[model samples]
Target chain A: MACMNEDGQWIVLMGLLTALGLFFLALIINQSALVGQTTAEGVLEFPKNDIRDLRSEIFDVYDSYGTLHAQGRLGDVEEDIIRISLERKNAVVHFGNDTPQDVSGRDLHPVTIHYNNGVTEYDEIVYY
Target chain B: MVNDSGQLYTMEGVAAGVIMLLTAYIVISTTSIYTPGDTHIPDMQLEQLGSDVLAMMDTPDREGGTSQLVGFVKNGTETCGGNDLRNEFLTNCKMRAGDEDTKLRAQVYLSYRRTDGTVNTTPLSLPDPEFTGRENAVRVTRWVQLDGILPGIPDIEHSSRPRAVLVEVLLWRA
Candidate 1:
């Protein structure tokens, strides 16, 4: 081994470095592609539209039928919502409104809504 | 040392390799790489557009005014008002900047609670004549608050109590 010169060794070393650099670049590209995939998957998985639609639907209930409570016919309607949400949406939902409270010289009902579908949980309290 | 003549060749190879790597990086960075998400892209777009249409239909043109969606639901399946809703929805969906999208179509359904305490879904619009049952469709729902008796629905018994109903639209491209 001592008879051989080591002058071309640097060339071999540089070729190895070049190969490593290219591998790193490929890895970086793969990581970037992963980023894009997660973004789209995240948007589709979270039921943003479903939650918003539920909120609006609850508000619509309040608009048509006065203040809601846990008793009488209004309670039955609320039960309908909860049961249907669980069945069709694969989500558990509960919502109700109490007697109107004075807000800025106006009487508005205090409504509360709770929703959970395993992945996400949401709670909302609004006056209508 | 020994054989310094090959040093120039080594230097040229190193330069070429570095240049190629840098060029590749620049080119890749400039263009977008859509991986694993292209399959869901069309579904995402259709869902967004469908939701937008439902939201717009439910929105009142002016403050403290009734929306067209509510009016159609109140008219029920027995009347021509439901037909109007279908027409309006299709027209809105097909309308675009460049040209009308005739391939887009929709069917409407109403979900209501029965007296026995179960939810029931009834079709407000008939099934599409061209529907082969294999087309991919997105269902978008909006809540409609109906006042008093559901006079139009033959199945449901009339009750004086107000109620909330779900209006669902299934959109697809033929």
Candidate 2:
């Protein structure tokens, strides 16, 4: 009877400890689910405005291609894009327009644009 | 001393109460709830799609002819012919890489500086009937530098000089 008296107390303590451990484990699992979902959600929310603004600036340079290239100002614009991308956006960007080629009856310049922002990378060879 | 036989039952009751309290608190606190409106992910996706469609339409397939977007802006009048712009926008937006269709609607507006050097907005596309003042919409804008006067709708009397007009399209999904 003396052994039984203290033995049941130990059993109740052990059961309580196990219950607490399971509760903690469940909490950890609940939080881990959120971590994965937020990561994928962030990727889905792409920096679309940034890409659009970059494309617009590139085309703006293209629009003034003749004067800017002749004045060597195009080099400065390109350098600005690369430098700012590295400093502010944490991206590496490079774009170039090849010699004009005939595509479907129009003399269009083939522009190759490469953009990588660590998380996402986009490459395009669009005719403009 | 009195027999402590009921002490074990009292301890059991306390233990069960503590466990129940803890589980109730944890369950209430950790109920992970999510709503689509809480996250701006859908809005971001729709905005990106709208901007991409506008950019593509602005780009001329060839060098000489006017871009579809520019032509639409130049020829557009108040309350007329915006249907074409809306239709063309939907046509491009609905075409996905996997040929999936998205249900989206848009209202287009043009922002320009008048001769008095003030900005003005004129509607190019009418809003849909479903736009009952509560739908969430995103506005996508593009700059279109017009070389000549906007042909129709003499509300502000624009000059023949080059005007940099902004094409703002308010897009929403049904």
Candidate 3:
């Protein structure tokens, strides 16, 4: 076969380059959509609200410990929290409060709360 | 007479047309993939808003006090009124930047453990007859500590003792 004129072959090369560029752009866009999906899934899975709600509930237990109708039944309430969290939420939760001590001119209990599900683990010591 | 010099330009033009169509197809298909991912964004938003509302409800208006949720749910029906709780919750959820939102509705339930080590869930509010029970509804739950003998729950202690309970709310559009 005889070779034809090669004068405008750069047009074909430029078209090839443009096609490569578009392909990469599509790849990046697809990857970005994946990133967005994972970010939303991560926020949903982290259980931030669950942990916060658990902490507040623990504080309420302490508030009701020696007063109201629950006087002298703190242990049973604590058990209630642990068992329920494990059973319903599929999370292990443990919390305890130390004796009240004077801090900043007021008595405060040092409370430690720990929570762990399969994915997220959180622990905190809060004064109340 | 047949002309041949213009054939190169014709070939390039055809090549350009093909590339443009291919590019458009690729772009459109890639963006379609994005819509499926975008669905999660709305769920994320609803879940976050539901969580924030529940947390705010659990917060006491005054320092060193039980929130309205605790007060209304206390002791399993002593001070807790289902109507009052639902009204309070709806009011909080409906607040918006513009006209008061009228589209949100909620149903409340309480879950506690029985003596047999099983959990029982009871309604804290009357079930809305209009609820269609959409799967898109977001469920937000908070922990409530009750300090009296719960009477309605089956297989639990009848003595006046403190216990932990879960307050769950299903929020959805009307």
Candidate 4:
């Protein structure tokens, strides 16, 4: 009888120990999941710079305007001025009376270039 | 008769031993205990904070028909009175007007754990456009580290444990 009682006590102790170990294992897993969630969320918050190149292109166009003004090749200074404006899907460059008379074809200086869609047009307006 | 008394004593001893073992396990597990398999709690906290900061950076503020990225950090204030962790964090952020260009302002808060197990909080304002500007905000990028250890956790000599989280916010206004 004494031996049986001792064995029973040992079995109960072993069972308690196992239960505690399992509990800790579960806690560790829960903590891991929480950490994973945070890391994933942080990864999503990072910013992207897709428009940087486009902005630089716009600046280049502005710089070209300055260069054209400095060069004497442009004739009829009063009427050949060009102004660029951005529309919904295209960049419109309005040509004044000062525009070059020989301007034509792909060789014509394009004041505006549509980035999203491939469309380019020069509008000439002569003010009386 | 002697056999019965001895059995009872043995049973009591075993019961007491088991109870003590369980109590010790609970105490160790609950307090000042570090396990190799435990998850990186500080890393997780930093990650969450980084996300909140990024989200604030992404938000657009409208002024004079132009949308701008405006971020303000206020500490110990109820600016963003909400229960969400992100909102709570924002509420602690403060923004101040300084210099000729208000668009180039930044508010930063630093939190460090002290030796007495208390948190020491500090507020810092970045020099106008020093850390970020309209260009930086427009081109802001973010990256996070995924290692077992966390950055700035108390008293564990694992400083180089690749557990540091970094949040970079670019400021831009158009």
Candidate 5:
């Protein structure tokens, strides 16, 4: 067979180059979108507000500990906290305030709080 | 006419190229990936920290005593006690396992109701000097229930009655 006239060979080469360039550009854009999405998702996933709320509630209980203990309702309140956290929030939660320890000339009680949802776990020993 | 059979192949190639370019452009533009350094996450974190600090200050460490937050609101003058509030807020917010400073600044405002039922806001703390009026500040508020009207604040007919007041804090990193 005789060789055909190759008049438009440059068009095909240009088309391939354009396609490759576009492919790379798309890849880079895809990676950038993933970066933003993961950052927002990670922030949303971490239970910051839950941990803060739990800490405040624990401190409130600590504040009222003497009165609640005198009235024998401390255990009830503690049970309520744990049960509600487990049932509603899907987190196992427990906290207890130890005897008031003198730190820097101030009586501050050492409180230990534990929290665990399926996704994240937080434990802290805060002086209230 | 060059009796061109290659014209059809060239046309096909042009169409394919146009289609691929359009697809890539649309895909890239439609995703619209925003810059990750936007204000949302930091605002959320600052607001959360401000609220946590406020709530902590409102909690009394022992029974039968008023919370420090309540006392500050009830007795604070327009210019005084802001230092204490600022110091305490910074102390609580910056306290971590390590002693690294978080470099946060806050200004407190109190919202109360007049006797004719108009809500008023009064500044309890001043914003820092570094606040150049363009910072990304977050406002966090808390409801403080008082047994009696705040003593220092004037122009309220129900000063002797129980009231619920809102304490707002504008927080930013200086």
Candidate 6:
């Protein structure tokens, strides 16, 4: 009687372990399937507005410079504007009117413009 | 008596193990093989629309001048023709009528190059449309404007001047 009871308990224990293992396996599989579906859906939605925003910010910087030129607060009238370039996201405004006196006087000027992206950079020139 | 009970219990354990194994196998196989259907539209249409708008700006009538581009994509089930799309774009972008009475929503701004050798920038604002004409669609609008600067500085003046033109493009589903 004792031996029979011991064998019965062992069999029940094995059955219980098997059931638990299968349950965990099913859970893992279901979670993986859900993740895969979400990733695929996100890929299809092309965010067009994001691209447009970046392009717009680039133009905003240009408009600010144009406004300053029309205002006449930038430099001397007779001074010839040499090369104007936007480098390192900063505006590089060069002038041909740099006199020896102006260079020695350390009158180098700097102006900062704020773009739509909140990027602020200075426009400066080095006299030769 | 003991032998008979032991055999019965052993058989029950084997049956349970078999059931568990089969369930685990089914789960694993289905999880690995299943895939969602493809539903994403490519960028070809949008790119083409942008190019066409850019081409229009180069026309003598349009004259690639300084201007802003703004519009939005409406979500609905309706198909939009050229005229309808243009009207919607103009309304959302806040474009004005040109001398020829052409409702101009998208504008191009010409400006000097930045220090990085790229063109200067303008600010853009996009408005959403009230009515979406297509299902699962989104409205996108952009407003672009030239940047202004301080006066009297020749370098700064020329730098701030419009050199390269900005072309704003708007599009919708056909």
Segments in model 5 whose C-alpha atoms lie over 4 Å from true places: A1-18, A21-128, B1-37, B78-80, B97-102, B154-158
lDDT of 3 by residue, A1-128 (tens): 13665565557656766776677667667666675678778888889889878887787777765673335667777777888888778999999988988899999999999999989999998889
| Model 2 native-contact share | 0.01
Ranking of all predicted structures according to DockQ, beginning with the best and ending with the worst: 1, 3, 6, 2, 5, 4
Residue-level error in angstroms, candidate 5, position A89: 26
In model 3, the clashing pairs are B72-B80
| Residue-by-residue lDDT tens digits, candidate 6, A80-100 | 122222321122333222333
List the candidate 4 regions with Cα displacement exceeding 4 Å: A1-128, B1-7, B35-39, B63-174
- Give the per-residue lDDT digits (tens) of candidate 2, residues A1-128: 55354545656766876787677668755664564356546755465665666677577668878867776656655665655555445679899999999999999999888888987788888888
For candidate 5, give the lDDT of residue A38: 59
Candidate 2 chain A lowest-lDDT run of ten: A1-10
Query: Per-residue alpha-carbon lDDT of model 2 for B76-112, expressed as tens digits?
Result: 7633356678878888888877745665778887766
Tell me the whole-model lDDT of each prediction, alpha carbons only.
Answer: 0.76, 0.70, 0.75, 0.34, 0.69, 0.37
DockQ for each numbered candidate: 0.35, 0.06, 0.29, 0.02, 0.05, 0.08
lDDT of 3 at A20: 67
In candidate 3, clashing pairs total 1
RMSD for each of the candidates: 4.2, 9.9, 5.7, 22.0, 11.3, 14.6
For lDDT, the strongest prediction is 1
Candidate 5 docking DockQ: 0.05
Native interface contact recovery, all models:
0.27, 0.01, 0.48, 0.00, 0.04, 0.08
Off by over 4 Å in 6: A1-14, A33-52, A60-64, A67-128, B1-134, B139-174
